[model samples]
Target: MCMKHRKLLTAGIGLLLTVILIALVRLVDAAPIGAQGTSIGLSHLNQFVFDLFGVNMLWYNITDWLGVAAVLTGFVFAVTGLVQLIKRRSLLKVDREILALGGLYIVVIGLYLFFENVIINYRPIIMPDNTSPEASFPSSHTMLVCVIMGSAAMLINRYIRNKPLNRILRAVCYVIIGVTVVGRLIAGVHWFTDILGGILISVTLLSLYEEVISHGK
Candidate 1:
C-alpha cells in the first residue's frame, strides 16, 4: 500500500482503539471506587493497579514538570513560527511544518479542555489542595507528553542538518515521553485505562500530524 493509505489506516486504527477502550471502561466493572467514593469506570482493574503501585507524589510531580517541559518545547516552535512570519511578512511564507505543529498543538489543547469538562473518572487519590477527586481519564499529562514529544521527534530530522545532534534530540524526546508515561502510571494518579486512552489518542493525533508534514516535504 502507499504511504498515504498506510497513514490513514493507522490513524483509523488508533481512533477505533480509543473508542473501544472508552466503551470497555464504561461497561466493565465500573463502580464508585475512586477517591472520596467518586464513580470510576473499570473500577475493578483500576483499583487493582492503584493498589499495586500505590500513590507516589514525587513521581506525579516529576511527570507533571516533564509535561510542562514538553509544552515549552512546543512553545519554542510557536515562537519560531511567529518569528518567521514577522521576517517574511507573510504567514504563508512561514515554515509549513511549524505551522502544522501549531495546528496540532491547538487540537491537543482543545482535547485537554474537552476532557477537563467531561468527567470519565476521577483520580485514584485526591490531589493536594483539591478537596475532591479531579478528572483523570485519558491522563492529560501522558497525552501531552506523548503528542508533543512524539511530534517534535518526527519533525527534528527535517530541520536539523547535524545527524548526531538530530539523533540526540530525538532520543531525548523519546526518553521524556517514556518517563512521563511510565511515571504517570507508577504515580497511581490515573487508572490503567486512562493511560491506555491517552496513548491511543496520541497515536491518532501523531499519525495525522505525520501525514500533514509528509505532504509538505
Candidate 2:
C-alpha cells in the first residue's frame, strides 16, 4: 500500500480501537449501576439538549428538515453522477469518483445496518422499554451525514479557489456534522457511546477511501 493509504488505514484503526476500548470500559462500569443510575445522569442532559433543540425553534426546524435533506442530498448526488455517466465528459472523472465512493458507502452502510438490526444488540440506556430495537451503537445517521457532507465540502473546497466561498462551505460541513452529533445525543436515539463508535467507523472508512481509492485514480 501507498504511504497515504497506509496512514489512513492506521489512523482509522487507531480511532476504532480507541472507541471500542473506551466503550468496553464504560459498559463494564455501567452494568453494575443499572438503569436508575443511567437515567438520573441522562435526565439532566436531556433537559439541556431539549432546550437547545427548542431554542428559537431553530434546532427543532433543523431536526425536522434533516431526514428529508439527507435523503435528497444522497439522491441528488447519485442522479448527478448517473446523468454525467450517460453524457461522459467534463463530469466523467467526477462521475467515476462518485460511483466508486457510492459503492463503498453502500457497503459500509449495509454493514452498519446489519450490525444494528441483526447482530449487535444493545438497548438504549435512556429508554430501555423501547421495543423497536434501535441500534444504540454508532449513530449511523450522524456518521453518514458527517462523512457525506464533510467529504463533499472538502472536495468542493479544493476546486474553488475563492477563500470566502471555500471557508463558508467547509464551515457549513462542520456545522452539519456538529449539529447531527448533538441532535443524536440530545434526542436520546443513541447512547453517547453509540455516537462515538459511529464517528470512529465512518471516519476510518472514509479515510481509507480517500487515501487508497482516491490515490489510485
Candidate 3:
C-alpha cells in the first residue's frame, strides 16, 4: 500500500482502539463505587508517597498548578501552529497540516467528553471543597499533556537533527508524561481506572492524529 493508505489504516486502528478502551472502561464500571471497590482514589498511597518523597506539603498545591500548566502548554502549541499557518498561507504545507492536526485534537477531545457522558457518566468525583471543574475517566488534563507536550517533543526531535539534543528533548517529554501519570495516581484524587482510561484513550488519539494530519494529503 501507499503511504497515504498506510496512514489511513493506522488512523482507523487507533480509532478502533479508542472505542474498545471506552467500552472496557464502561464494563469495569459495573463494579459499584463504594463496595469492595471503595472510593478508588489514592489518598493513602499519595499520603505515604508524599511523606516518603518529602513533598507532602507541596504535592497537592503543585498538582493543581500542573494541571493548568499542562493545558496552557497545549494552547501554546495550538496558537503557534495557527500563527505558522498564517505566516506561510501562500505555501501552506506542513504548517497547514499542523494546524489541522490541532483542530482534529479538539474534535477527538469533544468525542471523549461525549463518550464519558453516554458510556459511564464518569465525572471527576473530587472533594466537595475542591474548586476545579469535574472531569473523569481519562483525565483530560493528563491527556492534554501527553498530546500537546508529546507532540512538541516529537516536532523538536524531527526538526533537530542533532542526536544529543533530540535525545535530551525526548527524555524530557518522557519525564513530563511519567511525572504527570504518577502524580495523578499518587494524589488519590483520580481512581486508578480513570488514569488508565485516560492514558489509553490519549495514546489512541495521538496515534490517530499522527496517522492522519501528520501526513500529507
Candidate 4:
C-alpha cells in the first residue's frame, strides 16, 4: 500500500484499540473493587498485575522524575518551533513539520485533560502524596513521553543531517520510551490496561500527525 494509505490504516487501528479500551474500562468499573466503589480495572489482568508487583517506591520515583524530563523535552520542542517562527516571520517558513509537531503536542495535552477529567479512572494504588484519585487509563506519562520523544525522533530523522547524531538521538528516544513504559507498569500504581490505552492513543495521534505533515509537504 501507499504511505498515506498505510498511515490511515494504522491510525484507524489505533483509534479502534482506544475505543475498545474505554469499553473495557467501563465494564471493569461496573464491578467495583470495594465498598468505596473504586473501579478495579480490566477484570482479567488487573489482579495479576497488582499481585505481580505489589508496590515499588523506587520505580514510582524513577518514573515520576523521568516523566518530568519528558515534559520538559516537549516544552523545548515547542520553544524551538516558536523561535523558528519568530526568526522566519512566517509560520509557513518555520517548517511545516515543526508546526505539526506543536499541533500534535496540543492534541496530546487535550486528550490528557479530557480523559483525566471526563472519563475518570483512578489509579490502582493511590499514593499518599497525591490529593485526588487521578485518572489512570491512558497513562499521561506514557502518552506524553511517547509522543514528545517519538516526535523528537521523527524530527531528528528529517532534519538532523548528521547521521551519527541522528542515530544517537533515535536510540535515546527509544530507551526513554521503553524505560518509562516499563517503569510505569512495574511501579504497579496503574493498571495494565492504562498503559495499553496510552500506547494506543499515542500511536493514533502520531500516525495522524505524520500523515498530515507528509501531505502538507
Candidate 5:
C-alpha cells in the first residue's frame, strides 16, 4: 500500500480500538444497576443527553426513513457494480477496489444485524405501547446512514470526474449524516454513547475501505 493509504488504515484502526475501549467502559459503568438504580450511561452522559433533547417522534420517523433511503442509495451503487461485472464477463474486469467496497457493505450490514440481536445498550425510553425494551446502543440508523451515504460519496468521488457534482454528492452525504446523528439524539430513541459509537465505528470502517481501495486502484 501507498504511504497515504497506510497512514489512513493505521488511523482507522486506532479509532476502532478507541471505540472498543469506550464500549467496554459503557458496559462496565453504564449498565443498569438494579430496578431501583439509575441507568448510568457513558459515565452518566446519557442523562445529560436526555435533558438536552427530550424526545420527538417526528424527527425519529423522518430520520428512520432517511436511513432507508441511504441504504437504497448504497444498493444502487452495488447494482451498478454488479452490472459492470456481468457486462465485462470476467471478475478480473471488475474494479477490484469497488469489489472490496461491496464486501465492506456486507460486513457493515452483518455487524448491524449482530449488534441488534445481541443487545448491548438498551434504549433510554421504553416504547409507549410495547413492554419489550429497545436496543439503543450503537444506533443502527446512525451507522447505516454513515456507512451507506459515506460509502456512496466515496464511490461518487472515485467515478465522477465533474468537480462540482463530486462536491455536491459529498455535501449531500455530509448533510444526511449530520441530520441523522442530530435527529436520532433529539428523538431520544438512543443514548448519547450509542450515537457516538455508531459514528466512530462507521467512520473507522469507511477509512479502512478507502485505504484498501486506494491501494488496489
Candidate 6:
C-alpha cells in the first residue's frame, strides 16, 4: 500500500479500537464498582487491577506533574509560533509544523472536553478536593502526556539541528510518556480500560499528526 493509505489504515484501526473499548465498557461486566458506588464497565477486571496496586497518591502526583510539564512544552511551541507571527506580521509566516501542532492540540482539548461531559466512567477514587467522582474515561493525563510528548518526539528532529540535543529531547519525551502511562495505571485512580482508551485515542491522533507533518515535507 502507499504511504497515505498506510497512514489512514493505522488511524482507522486506532479509532476502531477506541470505539470497541467504549462499547465494551458500556455493555460488558458493568457494575457499581467505582468510587461512591458509581457504575464502571468491566468491573471485575477494573476491581482486580485496583486491588493489586491500591491507591498511591505519590504516583498520581508525579504523573500529574509530568502532565503539567507536557502542557508547558506545548505552550513553549505555541509561544514560538506567536513570536514568529509577530515578527513576520503574518500568521502564514509561522512554521507549518507549529501550525499543525496547534491544530492537534486544539483537537486534543476538544476531545478532553467531550469526554468530561459525556461521562463514560467515574474515577476509581474521589480526588482530594472533589466531593464526587470525576470523569475518568480515557485517563486525560495519560492521553495528554502521550499526545503532546509523542508528537514532540516525532517533530524534534525537524526543529533542532543539533544531533545530540535532538536525541536528548526525544529520549526525554519517550521517558515522560512511558512514566505517565505506567504511573497513571498504578495510581489507582482510573480503570484499566480508561488507560487503554487514552492510549488508543493518542495513537489515532498521533497517526493523523504524523501524516500531516509528513505531507508538508
Best candidate, lDDT-wise? 6
Quickly count the clashes in candidate 1.
0
List ranges where model 5 is wrong by over 4 Å: 1-28, 31-40
Q: What digit string (tens of lDDT, one per residue) describes model 1 on residues 5-93?
A: 89989999999999888888877787988898887777888888889999898999999899889989988888899999999999999
Candidate 3 whole-model C-alpha lDDT, 0 to 1: 0.60
TM-scores of all candidate predictions against the true structure? 0.97, 0.70, 0.68, 0.92, 0.86, 0.96
RMSD of each: 1.1, 5.5, 5.5, 1.9, 2.8, 1.1
Tens digit of lDDT per residue, candidate 2, span 100-152?
56875696678667766653334344343553444445566767776677566
User: Looking at candidate 4, what is the lDDT of residue 198?
Assistant: 90
lDDT of 6 by residue, 1-217 (tens): 9898788799999999999999999999999989999999999999999999999999999999999999999988889999999999998888888899999999999999999999899999999989999999999999999999999998797888999999999999999999999999999989899999999999999999989888945
Better of 4 and 6 by lDDT: 6
Clashes of each: 0, 1, 2, 0, 0, 0
Displacement of the residue 88 alpha carbon in candidate 2, Å: 1.7
The 10 consecutive residues of candidate 2 with the worst lDDT sum are 32-41
lDDT of each: 0.90, 0.59, 0.60, 0.82, 0.78, 0.93
RMSD of 1: 1.1
Worst 10 residues of 5 by lDDT: 33-42
Clashing pairs in 1: none
Find the 10 residues in a row with the least total lDDT in model 1. Answer: 38-47
